[model samples]
Target: MAKCFPEPYDAVSESKAELLLYKALAEQLGPDYVILHSVAWISRPGGSGPREGETDILIAHPVRGLLALEVKGGRVSLDYRTRTWVSIDANGVAHDIKNPFDQARRGKFALLEKLKESPAWKKLGIGRFNIGYAVFVPNVGDGDRLRGPDAPAEMIGDRRDLSDLGAWVGQVLDYWSGQEGAGQQIGTRGVDALVALFARSVSTRPLLSARIADEEDVRFSLTIRQAAILDILRRQRRVVIAGGAGTGKTLIAREKAVRLASEGMRTLLLCYNRGLADHLREQCTTIGGLDVATFHQVCHRWIERVKAKNGRDLLSEARANLPRGDEFDHHMPMALANAVDTLGPIYDAIVVDEAQDFGDEFWLPVEMLLTRPDEAMLYVFLDENQDIYRRSAEIPVQGEPMVLDRNCRNTDAIHAAAYSHYRGAVVEPPQISGVEVNRLLASGIEKQAALIGTLVTKLVVEEGVAPHEIAILLCDPADRPARERALQTLPLPATVKLGRVEDFSRGGLTVDTVARFKGLERAVVILWAFDRCDVGKDRETLYVGMSRAKSLLYVVGSREACDHILAAQT
Candidate 1:
């Protein structure tokens, strides 16, 4: 069982006779031999007679050195008068082909010249070992017809010699070994050197830009996991999609919205994150029937419409009556429901993304906006583990939920760090492998902030990363003083400045809270977890920030916090 260069060889030639001979040789040869199919070579300038040629099959034998075989597949013959070779295929078509004997000789000499330049071959003293050339006409039966001045009957093989090809090969090797200093042993080392010199070794990492492009292409390609979700959406009018982070819920929601809008259904794609809504708006603006907005944005629009239709200032009236903390959160959704009930339905279908973070009161307004409250289309995509807002992930819809647990956004390391606090259905990690999560330990917030500054400089200036692709997320954004100190104290490049998450496309790193940055992703993320405590409330906050990074992630925190994470993971 000889090992071929391309295992499970497929013929590249015009005829199948070469495949037949390849099988015969591969089966007849021993394990010590290597048969490379269709070995191509280019002669160095001022080195060999022929410029370039391809050897049908090159055999590397430890005992007999090297052998090149030129195989002519189909009915082959020679025109005696003009001394030219002719071939006729099974289609009754005649064509002229180069003499296989001449091809074999050129290929043999070219290979010999190639090995002579290899330092390993020269040092091993097997550079000038016996290199033989032979021709094989698999369709031809009579060897006498191929016998000529150049094509010796003993050196060539025909149809009768197909069986026991090893014996015929030995006969060819013996004929070439007659010349002085022709038969030399090529040990295992020589064969290794030959393979190495021909098939060059690659020992370098890929470019970051190339790696990013490749991963993006693979990541975005529609998988059966997503298609099945869409198929379910088409069948069911009301559905709930439950999954963990990176399960592609947002993608599924967007696709559903586009299909509904294309069918001329007034469609609304709604999400919790303002930045994500802005991004979706830009994408869906050209669409005639589609509209994208945040939950609050939709609430405000309907509230204003109610005021215009009827002389009712719902927002001001509700603002005065509602509590200080619940002023905007509770009233907007309540007011939106009142406005929609009075003003009637505004959309045929509504697809809600990041439903885990939306207030429980928001679902009433969402359902009321649909043309048919009970019969119309309503799809909710949520990740229970990503409920960073501490709200009850409630949707007053019917039936069981469909889950997408195969994570496809963040890298493997990022997924692990984020899912550490996850408490739901098991989530599969991203297919792409990445560097380990960077864990930097500092004593306090000031030290961690300074370390973040140094990391920003390195990632931007030294690593050639675009500033806009970077983001800094805070776990404790309610602490206004800490947020300001972290962003101002960082020693970032002069060209790189801080901007809001939604409006940083021009040039700037996005600075936002982890909860606000949900449903959005960045190529690079620096999570501000300096004061991260092992509490249930802090669980999803850090997970949201960790999962937001697609390519790179840096976790800067206190020494105690860092030790806790590392030990727990270990």
Candidate 2:
């Protein structure tokens, strides 16, 4: 009597166990009855291939046509709370074992099919032997301790008790052997007959249906990128969003925030930097939607509002309750640590923008705030390619990424030029039409500025394009002297070195850093200043800078830099 009977057997274990059981049964029941295990019995055509089905063991006697057995080894107790059997361990941890009667009933149908294939079965007449169930419990702690409702099977406390088993087996054989002369009984057809018999035998009723009602659809509209983000949010209980500059990752985040809020689900929009948080907050406000704040700000509000209402000093409490492996460094921000400690779960969804820049440590507190399997979802947006601070920044996301490939904003020419110059890493080209890209060589800063200024005048004045539709992008904002000269020489009002929303006035010509202008699009012209010599390493910066334009790209660079762009185009 093994204590670990029916202990989580897989296909191989079940096969091996079946073989051992067959040998044991032959010795106990004598040579009269036939014992079979793991027999492939197929009836349904063009359905799933024959695999493991219910009946694991079958016994047939001259009088009895077939008998099915389900076995297990454990102390079973009735769960008064769950109204089921509670199979507990030595440490009192309970496992809800599925009922053995259910297993026996399923096995009965499978056994009947196997019986029909046997010549001996037809000789005895299939209806002569009465089918029944046997449940073998090998190591019952107390033999008479019955739990829950009785099952369809004749419950045996211990299979090791050969005297009791041998007597019961003999009686069943004799009764069926006497009935062999009885004419074949006409019975109700198919699985329904066996199911009805098994139901009458078991005290606990069988489940009649397993279907559940469908859920109502939630109404929402989103761009492809935004829809992809929402799909990930719905499928993966945990996720990260990474995007390069100008990919509209933040815009996607804002839309997600609005949708979640509309559903009356609390949503949080988090950013690593305060400036980006402020920017998102402004955008969310303009859209008349959810509250967007930096993670630190959220924590500060919780400490001041939530902890105060509870009359607890959150900082002191956190210091006293610090868990192991959570030691803090001196340079870590107190506000961040306090927020991580005192922050209440206010949001159903937590969307983090600039996720790539938010290092590994930034996620530790955020992870604590998430509710497992339900209640909350996490979405992080980032761009590995636009990660200029990699040497100093610790990226939080680990593994190959789920990338958004289709360029929804830029034109094909713009996307093509960007990807070509940037080692062809851009996943898909843009969908827009009527775009042209040009590469020009200049020896110095003044020459580069003159070329950019000429392109701006031609696009705005000659082509009848608006000045606001044109953009002048510099790889490094520190190269402002040339940017200023170009803006001063241009024939229209020009916005120079604009990084934030505040810097964007009623537009004419917009000038900004390549990094800042990554996710934005412009019509007519993009004046990219590739003033540096290490053009190969800076190719991505140039590519992203040039692709911002809808109609035309005018790249101004040194001859050595221009050669790299020409080679990329080829």
Which candidate has the top score in TM-score?
A: 1
Best by lDDT: 1
Clashing pairs in 1: none
List all candidate RMSDs to the true structure: 20.7, 19.8
lDDT of 2: 0.52
Residue 180, candidate 2: how far off, in angstroms? 56
Backbone clash total for model 2 is 14
Model 2 weakest lDDT span, ten residues long: 203-212
The lDDT per prediction is: 0.75, 0.52
Error of 1 at 435 (Å): 1.1
- The per-candidate count of clashes, in order, stands at 0, 14
| CA lDDT, candidate 1, residue 404 | 92
lDDT of 1 by residue, 1-570 (tens): 887765536435565877888888889988888887766643332322223456888888777777899988778889756889888888868889988888898888777766664445667875457778888888888856778888778877889998888888887887888753565678788787776554322221111222122233333544457655775465477789988877778777877787666544678999988878877776566777889999999888988888888989988777776756485578888788888888998687799998888887888888889766766678888888887677874687778889897887788988888888788888888888999888777877778778878888898899977777788888776664776566686767887878767556545778888877887777898877537455466787777778888889887787677656545445
Against the true structure, what is each candidate's TM-score? Answer: 0.60, 0.50
- Candidate 2, residue 369: Cα displacement in angstroms equals 5.8
